[model samples]
Target: MSKVDVQLADVSISPVQYQAQLLAALQMRDLDKFTQLLDHCRVDAFSSVLESACREADCAQFVQQLLQHGADPNILNPVLLQTPLHITAELGCYETLQVLLCDDKINVDALDWLGNTALHYAAQNKDQDTVLALLEHGSYIGSRNHAGDMPVSDIEPETLEKFLNTRLKMPNDESLLFKYDFLVPPVALDSALLKNKLSDEKDNVIKKLSSPSPEMDPIVQISLSSKQQHLLLHPIISSFVHLKWQHVQKFYYYNLAFYVFFVLLVTFIILHHHITAIDEHRKSCWLNLSAVCFFKIIMITLLAICCFCLIFKLLFQVCISPVQYLHKWSTYPQLVLTLLTINVLFIDSGTGDSAVTVITLFLAWTRLLLLTGEHPAISICFHMFQKISCTFLKHLAWYSLLIIAFSLSFYALFHDSKAYIAEKNVSSKLFHNPLISFFTTVSMFVGGFETKFLPFETASGTSHIIFIMFMFFLTLVLLNMFTGLAVSHVQNVQSKSELVRLTAEVNAVFDIEKLVLGNPVCIHMWMRRLNLSHNAVIVGIFKSFVYLWLSFSWLQCFRNIHHSVLLFPDSSFDYANIVYPFGNSVNVTWNYRLDHKVLLQAANIVQKKNDEARQQLDCWAVFESYEERLNNIEASQLRCEALQQEILQLLRLR
Candidate 1:
């Protein structure tokens, strides 16, 4: 009898012998013998053996016969917890895998002990045909393995190409036929694998399943987290903080409206205070004390809330180093306003009526103008002023010494003349006071002198001569020198206006980022409180309106008027161009920049070629690795052959 026939004949006699017979029939490609052996043995007793044969022999007919005879194709191995499909995919048994897939009972996405599916194995092995077959049989592409990697992620370029091409070529109509109805199965741990239940292996498996997937890009994850955290804070300011520059430009009008409202409210409060002071001065009972106090309280409360917002912003700026934070121009004004607010809140109410308080209020109002720096006219004016101030300070040291010498010389010569002018009531006493004499002399140089009030007739001739020289030096020489310095600074600022404007915008964005987006802990706590408040909706709406108003330009109308004047100048009127189609010739410059366009196109083409070359190199590397693995397998097979020859020689000697 043939070996397969003899094995089949003895199948009923022994379970082990029956499995051996079934493997022999599959290896020989004897479909009849394989089917007969399967029939003789119980389905469960020989199903695993049939699966092993299918994996090893590359026999599709044996797998099909076993499936027809009621062998469970989805049966997992006791040791590895892997199904026959996983084995076939790993071994590159494409035909056997196809046969197994035809049976709907098999779980194609079944996870092995490592949480890897059949498709993952196929991709890992770079078996293009097997990958395509698995994909055609409704395999999920996004299934993640234990390593948090999708089947196609981090694979060889050649294998990735095969996967992409197969997906692309799949017809829309045929896709419905292979639609997967995915249902995750509970993981079943093998008793042999998990013999010691308290071992680290169990904990490892649990941790693997519980951990977040590493498939997300790190940058995308961080951006998403930041967005979520911001959403939990004050949503309106968060929106403004994250707005694109183009959108911010378009939305400036809304912000302007907010600033106007804030300024009007402040004006109303100041007027109320003035009226209250007038009533007290006249000793009239026109205003009720209680009503005035209540009004003051309401205004103070509103100011306090505004101050709180500013303080929150300052806290965020604390993330930056002290020197860096102090370097910003806006920080100084903000700090002053914050300190003024704190003083008003903690000190006596009468302090708000003091001259210092009034001066501080005026400063706070002026600081609001800084928000309009985005306007070109305002930005240029500010740049010019800053330059002039810096230049003035650089020259102040030498100018001070010259003024001091003239003042001391005049005071010494005119000291005795004060007695003679005392009866005339001409205030010649200024010469007796050193500090006052210095100011009076400087003022006289600037054309503040009144000859009727001066005792020049009574003073000595030396004093008169010294005063004339001082006036000439201070007015003609020093005044003109300062004027020339200021003019030079304006010219320098105008030449570099665009650079200054860009730098201001960048600095503004950095400050806003520090204030609005920094301090996650504070934002989180404030958000929590905001969420719990009953008036949150009304407060949010009001806050949004106020914030939008503050962000807008109060002088936008004037800026627009300036822009119009520049566009249509009275001196250089282009009447012919205005009447004709070509109103302005400036747009032609944009089209003339062909060099830039050509350079951009060349860069794009070069980038595409580089990407293609990199892909080719990756494919070559994969092939080289495969060749190395094949060489190792061949060497191992030769060693086994030599050992077999030695065993035969030992048997012959015995």
Candidate 2:
């Protein structure tokens, strides 16, 4: 049963007395005293409901009692001029709001100082029920707040349309209709549509959007300003990037598999041919290949095949973007290592070419880290390594001055002192060169401690003070300071690691795109390759033979990939039928006076949905042109009529 909100019999009571009684009843939840005061001015029903609401499910009217008593529900908070209902909806006080909305006298459309109505707050907070309730009670749909944002601007249009129409009765206000009158411009006399409009708009948009240009990408540039470049990690955009990476990463894996097997073969060759050298200087050496056996020749042939595959991969990548490939850290390392491995094929010299191969082998294994760094989970550590190493290198130049200064001073102080330089001592050897002292100082900074490899027998008191000071400054202060800064930086980077991973993902994706859809050169190359093989009988047969040879079980991952397919050829995606799914159920009446949002496409998603929406986007341009043509024809007709009327008037006068 519905309980009375308030029933104050005494009309003789002052507004101050009623306001004081109302605040007390709401705060204390004492319905007996409140009802005693309200009937004689009492609040007993209000207190019982407020207190019992927790234990009982069917408690009638807590705040609903206060509303019945003419306790103003529209009371503004003074700061924002927001009423109780505005706060309730904004803070998501659903239970109290139900009670408040039951009393119709509560002003649902009350505006704050920012001119935001209760509906604006409800929509912003994403309170669907409050938004519907306010809309049902006639909240203005087209009302722009002081920020020039309507309620729809904050809330999703899909959600509002889904809930509002099915639930609430349509309001009578013109603003509630939300129909926009899209104005088309009047016609120019010239035939602009034939050629002029091509240069004007469409061509420029295609140019800006066709390539991997940074001009259109918004959040992708979010990390550009940051110290460590990171991509904006939105759910939709990140997923798109991940899918894009999947399309292109198989080539890298193919090349990586070949390189990995090649390194393993190099390992086997090193072990089989290695020997302890009789030379005093060299401890170990590779045995010369004087007796080449059948198994050895097969291993060599396998190595040659791996080398051929890798060289082809390198050439393919380099030709796609020569300048980028040459300069890239990823490409140049692989190239240098491959060249070193090739050197062993020519030179049979003992220990030299095998030594080169050993270095390449070390790099080949280490390079696995770089290859795997493209992955999102692992990229963070590599990014952190890069950022931290960069921090060290940039600061190392400055710190080198201190090491040099200390080294030179130490050398100058005791270089020629007969007492300090013992015949068999390391100091005698080290003090002979300032360069040795500088290098030793640097080594000591990392590995060892103290200035002495030996005790100073007869150094000055000034030298002793200097030695203590150098140790204190370099080891204690400087080292700890570097540690603190690095620790702090690590902590800072930890917070932004997710963003770093996303940017690395974007970087990895675009690296693949640079060979396919993104670069002008790559796209041209794609089209060129397609044209060469494009339905040509001989070329198709050659490609078929090549693919047949490559159709090994191991190459399954790369079998689906081909150059012609990389161009992302147009498919039967029906763009012409692209239409808004909701037909008449939605009504979003827009005032023409509001400020328009400037941006268009999300550049990261870039034209993937162009098949779905491209024609519809271009339709507005054609419609405008058609409208202008009609206007021009109508205007000419009016002028011709006026001329004929003038001629008739002249004939009548004669």
Candidate No. with top lDDT:
1
lDDT of 1 by residue, 461-523 (tens): 876787677767888888898899888888888886654554443344433323322322222
Off by over 4 Å in 2: 1-231, 246-252, 267-296, 348-350, 353-362, 414-428, 449-452, 513-654
In order, the Cα lDDT scores of the candidates are 0.54, 0.53
lDDT of 2 at 422: 41
Per-candidate TM-scores read 0.40, 0.45
- Minimal lDDT window, size 10, model 2: 180-189
lDDT, candidate 1, at 366: 77
- Tens digits of per-residue lDDT, candidate 2, 145-183, equal 454455755554445444322321113221122111100
Best by TM-score: 2
